[model samples]
Target: MQTSKSTTRIISISFFTLALLGCQSAYYGALEKVGIHKRDVMVSRVESANETQLEAKQQFQTALQKFKSVRQFNGGNLENIYETLNDEYETSAALADKINSRINDIESVSDALFEEWEKELSEYTSESLKQKSAQQLTKTKSQYRRLIRAMKNAETSMKPVLNVFKDQVLFLKHNLNAQAIASLKGELNNIESNVATLIKQMNKSIDEANQFIKTMSQ
Candidate 1:
């Protein structure tokens, strides 16, 4: 079977950096011995993070829609409505948590890869080649910095949005009456606005991720 162009390129990079990872943790050592490398893992994590952000964007929209439904609640099984809203909030919370973990995993692999890259730069015998490698490392790092910052900016909004969601769910659980839902009626605009802003941030982060991937590949 033919290896993907990108996978082959990552494998070729691993061939060079494998030595730089000397006596590293068993986790990395074992993976390196096979076909996977730090760069490969970093790329994988980035893709996972991108997928998560997209999922989160959708979930936020979904949750907002569920919240909007509260304004239209006209004498039904109040318990059922509360349960549905609660489920949406719970799912949104879980997605937010997953996004956080993915970002952390990306950062962990990123540091490892960059450290190995820096060390490998010095191993070049020719000054011209060493300088080129150093320049590439610097450029890649700059690009990565932008990508990580965008991701973090998006994460910053997560908690506030989640807090809003949690508060609504808790309020609904405590008081399943019209008054509790009436309070939610005014929040639809604010909730919609916040989710819209979050989705925009996520969109930017996804763009940055794609750019970073291209920078690394180059």
Candidate 2:
């Protein structure tokens, strides 16, 4: 009886979570009915993506700091250090995935908005208004093109830093000896350089997102 009750509770929680998520699309659709369309969603998503990049930049900085701190280890159990580094890698990878997901979301909304705009253009009675709408669409699409390219470049930049972190963490995990520590020290400079590059790219991408959001809002 207790086991059945626990299973039922878990299932209830899962269903509640799913229901909350389902409400998000419904909320957006509801907004559209009142004329708040996908363009607004795109602007909001770009802002969100910018914030995520800022957070991810800080995370990589923390990971770099942790990597540098490994040099101070004199003679103690290295398990904690390994665990911390692994955790950083995991967190960074998750953040990267978030950035990618945000990019996809922006693309999805942009596609929907563009398609709807094109269809509406065909239904327009005034040729002048249709031309104006087409021009606006082209301008918006150009801005989006620039924004997405910047974001993709930033996303591409994350992989090298992540790879370095993963390599060092896995090395330490298997060896867990003085030699492994020395090996990490040798890779520290390279890691620092990669993290610096990543920070620069993330900042540039954040700037692009900000610019895009501001323009879209206007």
Which one is best on lDDT? 2
Off by over 4 Å in 2: 1-29
Q: In candidate 2, what are the lDDT values of residues 60-155, reduced to their tens digit?
A: 999899999989989788888889999999999999999999998888778777887888999989999999989998998898898899899989
The count of backbone overlaps in candidate 1 is 0
Candidate 1: pairs in clash:
none
lDDT on C-alpha atoms for all candidate structures:
0.85, 0.89
The residue-by-residue lDDT of candidate 1 on 1-218, one tens digit each, is 98999999999899867754454556676899998999888888898999898888898888888889887778888788889888998999998889889988888888888988898987889999999889888887888889999999899877778888888788978998888788778777878878888888889999999888776665
The residue pairs that clash in candidate 2, if any, are none
Best by TM-score: 1
